[model samples]
Target: MKEKATLIVVGTPTKILDSYEKQHAPFTKYKFHLSKVYKGDGEEGTEIELLQDGNKDASYNVHPLMEVGEKYILFLERSSTGALIMVGGPAAKYKYNKEEKVFESIDGGRIDEHLERK
Candidate 1:
């Protein structure tokens, strides 16, 4: 999964910026504030827009969506339109557990164990 990702970062989802249809599928744009850059070109404290594959109203959208203010470790790739997207859908998103100081899989996908720590 890491091999396929163009960008890998730890960040918090700040807001849902927009929702729109692309190529007949629903897409959502999110405002993400970067806290760390494990792999890729992003700088800490930078805010980047991430595109997800579904909107809030899409019934068939099975990918786990990022909640506002929740911290996450994201594995992303660039879309053809030059937007960043999760590399493996829900599998690429891991929510940070502040109390436990660990990363929990949002959809049962296992990421590198080493990445679970700061």
Candidate 2:
């Protein structure tokens, strides 16, 4: 999945910027402060905006949204409008387990083997 992404980075969500419908689908824009760049050209501390599928309300969302201040490793690609989006929706986003010092898939899938290769 990382191979198909234009940008892959570890970052913390700073804020939820907006929630709007795009092409009839609800989407939310998030502001993330980069903490590490695993692949692609992003600098640590750089703030990047990510357009994720779903709205602010979790009840209507198919995928879970990023929680503010939580660290995440994201696999992203540029959309048609040049906005960064998760390459595989919920599958490509991983949340960091601070105590365990490892990342766990947001959707509850096991991806440690894949991450170990990095």
Candidate 3:
């Protein structure tokens, strides 16, 4: 099934917690500082967290670690608590290629193609 994404933005990751030593918890998390608003109400420079970790075997849906200072286009949804987060695991995250002026999917293409009607 296709997951619904309500928000889309270009932002930079401020921090990440994939190991137990960092967040003091078992789940992996990413904190992003929004830079560009694309499809949601996220304000520029505001921070949001993306959480999606459970156990060692649950890595299939996990988002890869984002590099600090690297801008990315994020497809997101609001959680019940009203926090912004990745809408469909790795499928919702894309890296912004500054020189190319395009959002490159983690799987190596533009997300627009997959999102459009065929």
Q: How many backbone clashes does candidate 3 have?
A: 0
Give the per-residue lDDT digits (tens) of candidate 1, residues 6-112.
88998899999998886789888999999988888999999999988788876244576678999888999998889899997888888877776677775554444
Clashes of each: 0, 0, 0
Cα lDDT tens digits, model 2, 1-118, are 9689888888899999998886788888999999888788888989999988888653234468788999888899999899999997887888887776778885565444236732
Quote model 3's TM-score: 0.65
Worst 10 residues of 2 by lDDT: 109-118
TM-score of each: 0.86, 0.86, 0.65
lDDT of 3 by residue, 16-84 (tens): 745333244344567888877766667887987776444243344345555678877777887786756
Model 2 lDDT vs. the true structure? 0.81
Question: Which residue runs of candidate 2 sit more than 4 Å off their true CA positions?
Answer: 58-62, 110-114
| Model 3 stretches astray by more than 4 angstroms | 1-3, 17-26, 52-63, 80-83, 111-118
Q: Which ten residues in a row have the lowest lDDT in candidate 3?
A: 109-118
In model 2, what is the error at residue 42, expressed in angstroms?
1.0
Ranking by lDDT: 1, 2, 3
Error of 2 at 83 (Å): 0.5
Pairs of colliding residues, candidate 1:
none
